[model samples]
Target: EETDFEKTIVDSLNIGFIPNFLNSFLDVLSTASIGLFSVLFISFFFLKDSNLLQSGILAFVSSDSEKRTVHSIDKINNLLSRYFVGLLLQIFILFVIYTITLFIVGIENAIVIAFLCALFNIIPYIGPIIGAVIMVVLTMTSNLGMDFSTVILPKAGYVLIGLAVGQLIDNFFSQPLIFSNSVKSHPLEIFLIIIIAGLLFGVVGMVVAVPGYTAIKVILKEFLSENKLVKSLTKSL
Candidate 1:
């Protein structure tokens, strides 16, 4: 029966699957490559002639506001660049921690799994939970043949523990530093913004909250430099 079942599964998979998958994969790869090359070409020119673009944008503003607009643009650029770099660094740190921990716990494809989980950290609050679920599923499937008591539960538990540890490090250390330093917001302020955004718009809101908050703060500081609340909130910016 087992052999028959295996053959049936194999036959099913063989029925036009490989060709269809290969064709779709090739199409996706071609499209992605084209898009990537286009972006690179445009970015190269943009970087080379950034001043021209800046001057053109400033030309639209009245002469009196041009200086303030330039300052605002510079501040926004600096803050966003640092914020993105900090996020990248956070992901790298998480990837390293996860890879080492999962490998130590004997999970299959630990490096790839870690990389994926780390990338998911780009989405705030909910992303780590999703990554952990994926890790557990992968680990359980890898150990499918093992006895449930002796091998499966214990190994899965160990993997979960490792993930929890990595998350702790990320939450307590990496995140605070990124929010406080990159966006120049107090950790508490960032925490509140994320919570409010999550409540209002779910995961998408949480993901954009920090960048949006930073941009708003910059603009407010530029225009409302004398307002007391704005003065306090945007002091760091």
Candidate 2:
């Protein structure tokens, strides 16, 4: 009986579809594997030579300025490390929230969908939109043969609501805390920067705004300590 069911499914599928799907899947897997390996290989070297940036800086600076240069480098490293670590924690928290919510909604592969969406958080404003779209697609496909009203609509609606709530928490609580504590910037300052960046350059602008602003503040404080604007902007730093 099981053999007949399997045979029926295989025969019902378009002959070319299976081959094409397998080929596409294989290609994607191969590409992802290569990229993953490349990142790991590069990360290993970066970790092993953690002092590479300091060494490079020292090599470029005069002997008399070495101390100040070292101080600046250390400050930048500390600030960036905190920012990145906080970002990771925020993403993890969001992932857990999304997974639990989707599971409650009776979505299949809830964990996987939630993970992808949470990971997209790294991309800033555009990430959530993309994640939500992906979630809806996954939910619909998972219930492909089910009654639309009874299964699909409810599942998809719940998934979307969950994503919306998760994003709200992230934006209001997680993001503000991370930006304020890690970057030593005021929540209002971070908010304004993001808004301005989005206005000027769209999604990419918003994504890079915080780090870019932090870097600028650090550099200005280091080089233009006497400047009034620099003093005010970098007081926290």
TM-score per prediction, in order, is: 0.75, 0.74
Clashes of 2: 0
What is the overall TM-score of model 1 with all chains considered together? 0.75
- 1-237 in candidate 1: lDDT tens per residue? 469889888877755777897687556444433433453355445445757867988989998988888898778767876777788788899899889877877887899999888877766766687678778878888889889899888878988887888889898888888888889999889889989987896565677788779878998999899999999999887
Candidate lDDT scores, in order, read 0.78, 0.77
Give, for candidate 1, the lowest lDDT window spanning 10 residues: 31-40
What digit string (tens of lDDT, one per residue) describes model 2 on residues 41-110? 5534543565896798699899987877777766766776678778778889889988998888778788
User: Which stretches of model 1 miss by more than 4 angstroms?
Assistant: 1-60
Worst 10 residues of 2 by lDDT: 31-40
**Cα RMSD (angstroms) for every candidate in the order listed:** 7.8, 8.7
Candidate 1, residue 211: the lDDT equals: 76
